[model samples]
Target: MAAKTDDSGPVLPPAIEYAWGLRDRPPKGPRPGMSVPAIVDAAVGVADADGLAAVSMSRVAKELGAATMALYRYVGSKDELLALMVDAGYGPSPGPPPPGTDWRAGLTRWAWAEHDVLRQRFWLLHVPITGPPITPQQLGWMEDGLRCLDGTALTEGEKMSTLLLLTGYVRNEATLASQIAEGSRATGAKPSEMMPAYGRLLAQLIDPARFPALQRVLAAGVLSQDDDPDDEFTFGLDRILDGVDALIGRRAAT
Candidate 1:
């Protein structure tokens, strides 16, 4: 697809235009076996099998059994392909809860849905986000997430901001969760074993006199034990939801 530009500036990159179906195939009839979706699939496969580092244009082309130049006919560049791959990897968001679902439950489901997507496609965490959602699938996820706050007292802008806050929290949590998974695989140790090792390493290296607050935490004996693996994520998400609930309460009061 051709890139869209205006007196203001470029609205959609060529790849995004192709993704959103704003434009058709690039000129000269893109190669017979070459399509944007095919190229992105090849790239995502490479990323999933190895990592982001394995997802160069040439690598994806090799994975597709096409010449590297052939991919350029559709994708434009590696960065463009990365953007397309990210949106494709996310696919579509699930439908929101049935009518009459409370805003808090709906929002919690939205956050967890985002979490699950990222968790499954851990490589997506490594994809750099350049801007807000504009790709069709990305916008679909955004639309579904916004529905969680529908019929609320919050203004449209506030609803959008709240989604940003919650989605950001989900992504941040996903990154850490992915790292922990990777560490466990590398070390052959479970999450429970890893935390205490980390705590012990900290206890030995951290000077209590120099770091009183950390010392206090260590003294509490919390890190030395194997807590629930999901305790941290659960606690953080609950706190964030509580804060959002309080905001809604205040808005309703006013």
Candidate 2:
């Protein structure tokens, strides 16, 4: 894998550099027992049990029963560790879209699969986007997403941009879903219970005269209703796909 770089070229962060095969494993550091994978896995374990905030080097070392310096043998910093953990969480791509699928169909599957991974590992949603996909699994996912646009009239740049757009949509949707899930867990209240309370708050706060569009939304009862997250996701995905199809059509026409 190609390493991440910049013109000024600060020392490459060890964890991501290792994943990109640009840096050596363990880097001649002490504690041969400490491996990058082990450190990342331990960090992930810490994050999983306590959340990303708890996944510091000290905490991860505590979880691994090693001194904090031992982890320094593997990961360069907590940010790199987080990058490794997030990419590890992805594991790998789910393989290419089904055979004979059109670009729309293929990209649709690609988007949904990406969405499902984020949903399953909701922690991935919380991982701050610091850089492009450099780790193996994330690169594979990027390739797979680009493959969905194979043979399309869209240029390579357009395919990459389309991926950025779709990825943003998936991440935003996953963030909302993850927040709802966390809220449910924290309050011990299902979304079905919580949304009504939420709607009522809006109802009390917004007068029809002051917020007619929002008031209309309240009157329609969609807010109070038990909305399926998947339905909302599908609606958004379809709209995006429609826009992409229009672009494809126009490109083909030209």
For residues 15-115, write the lDDT of model 2, one tens digit per residue: 66677788755555566566888888887777777777777889988877889987876776777778789888888897777789888888888888888
lDDT by residue (1-254, candidate 1, tens digit) is 22457999877766677677777664233567677778888888888889888889888878888888977777778878878888889988877767989888888887888888988889998987766667778888888888989988888998999989988888998898889888999989987788788789899999988999989988998789877745676788889889888888899999
In model 1, residue pairs whose N, Cα or C atoms come closer than 3 Å (at least 3 residues apart or on different chains), thus clashing, are none
The lowest-lDDT stretch of 10 consecutive residues in candidate 2 is 24-33
Model 1 off-target regions past 4 Å? 1-4, 8-11, 24-30, 184-189, 202-216
Top candidate, metric lDDT: 2
Q: Candidate 2: global Cα-lDDT?
A: 0.83
lDDT of 2 at 211: 98
* Models, CA RMSD each: 2.8, 2.9
lDDT of the candidates, in the order given:
0.81, 0.83
Residue-level error in angstroms, candidate 2, position 194: 2.2
User: Ten residues in a row with the worst lDDT in model 1?
Assistant: 24-33
Q: Give candidate 1's TM-score.
A: 0.87
